[model samples]
Target: MKNQSPIIEVAELFTISENPNLRIFDGRTGPNAKEEYLKKHLENSVFVDLNSDLAEIDNPKNGGRHPLPKFEDFIKTLGSLGIDKDSHVVIYDDKNGANAAARFWWMLRAVGQTNVQVLNGGLQFAENQNYPLSSGEDSYPETDYISGHQDWQLPQIWMDDVKLATQDSGSVIVDVRESQRYDGITELIDLIAGHIPNAKNFPFIDNLDDDGLFKSPELLKNLYSELFENYDQNKITFHCGSGVTACHSLLALDYAGFDIPNLYVGSWSEWSRNEV
Candidate 1:
């Protein structure tokens, strides 16, 4: 399959809405996500639940609130979604691309799929552009997706590795959460308020422009370069609450044409609980 750009515009999507190879997915999550999706979502877009489909969520205390689904299970999930190696997947969520949309993109990329992209500016942007929306569910033919690997090809670190990195001068743990949460001032999601020890806060919002679209590649490249100048790419690790939004920055790094760094998928959610 040919590689597509990591970002896709609303106009571009509208033009190819009927492409046989195009598979659209909505990755919105929350208590009301299903209800909202059923009420109205992009026409012909299949809804993928983050809590059940993308993550295992067996033990939040250990794996964080949204741990990645097992490799085999994920492959099966993709099969159910009609995804194959040749499919061109477009994903989006309500929170621009900062939510599970980027995570889905990262997951597809990790599995070596080349034809996946996140909808730039997400659902809101599409709505503003007058893209058609549909109520209720949609369906597509299923596929027989097969996994050739046992693990994610992407760089990821566990809590133990993060602990080692905290003490290692050559390594840096980067926290991509907001400043208040990082400072132990205000936290609404994870149980603890403080961030991981020795991890530097670099909020993921900085990846976007004032309009909520990602900034220019050059600007993102320079910004991340300065943040990671002292450490090698392999030594640098990125994380956020429950391992979700961390993919937002990872997506930015890849879009900025830099080598993707280690993702601490457990992130603050697992770290805070285990450390406490």
Candidate 2:
């Protein structure tokens, strides 16, 4: 699959609303998910649940609330969705690709299916553009995807990277989580209340204003470019709990035309499970 960078503007999607190979995934999730999806969504988009699709079964006390799912089972799930190595997948979620879209994007990339991308503004933007939404379920013939053993990629840094960055004083570790979570004021998902050892708190929410619209790309560039002025973009690693919301930062970087960095997939949630 020759996957060109597939970041598309809201206007661009209209050009290919009828491609046979195109598969759009509705990645909206959480308590509001099923209801929101039932109300409205992109026409012909398939639903991929977060608790079901993006997460693995786990004991309640485990570090990960929704851990990564098993491979064979995940493959079976994808196959039932009519997805395969040859498919050009477009995934999106209303929560800025944070909640579940990135999860599907990661799954596609993990399987060597490079022709996958997260919709920039997600379903809300699509609807705002007056794009059509359908109440009917998306139905397509099932695909029997012949699985290839993929070179498992871990383009992630661990606490080690954090420690090294702290000691050596080279690149910065930016936490893309909320400020409350960063300040040790709230312990939503982890044992420890504080952030990574020496990381800076640059919540992804800061990238947006009150309207839920992202700030101007130039403004974002001016803001973050100064914030990360001392470091090369590749040397930086974007992360959030279980490596999900961090994609918002990755998206932010892309919006700024900065070099995309490695993702620490297992963020603080995974880190909290480890013993020093």
lDDT of every predicted structure (CA atoms): 0.90, 0.72
Give the best candidate by TM-score.
Answer: 1
lDDT of each residue in 1-276, candidate 1, tens digit only = 324568888999999898999999999988999899999999999999888888899777888999999998999999999999888899999987888998999898888788888888999999999999999999679999865777899999999999899899999999999999999999898888998889999999999999888898899999999998878879999999988899999988888888889998898889998996
Give candidate 2 misplaced runs (Cα > 4 Å): 1-6, 57-63, 70-73, 146-149, 159-168, 189-192, 209-224, 232-235, 254-259, 273-276
What are the clashing pairs of model 1? none
lDDT of 2 by residue, 1-276 (tens): 234553555676677778888888898877877777877889888888877777775752353455567777778778888898777788888986766876677666666676777776788888888888987567556888756854434355655665566565667777899989888899877777777777788888877666565667788889888888888665677777766787677666656666657676667776666632
**By TM-score, how accurate is candidate 1?**
0.97
Poorly placed runs, candidate 1 (over 4 Å): 1-3
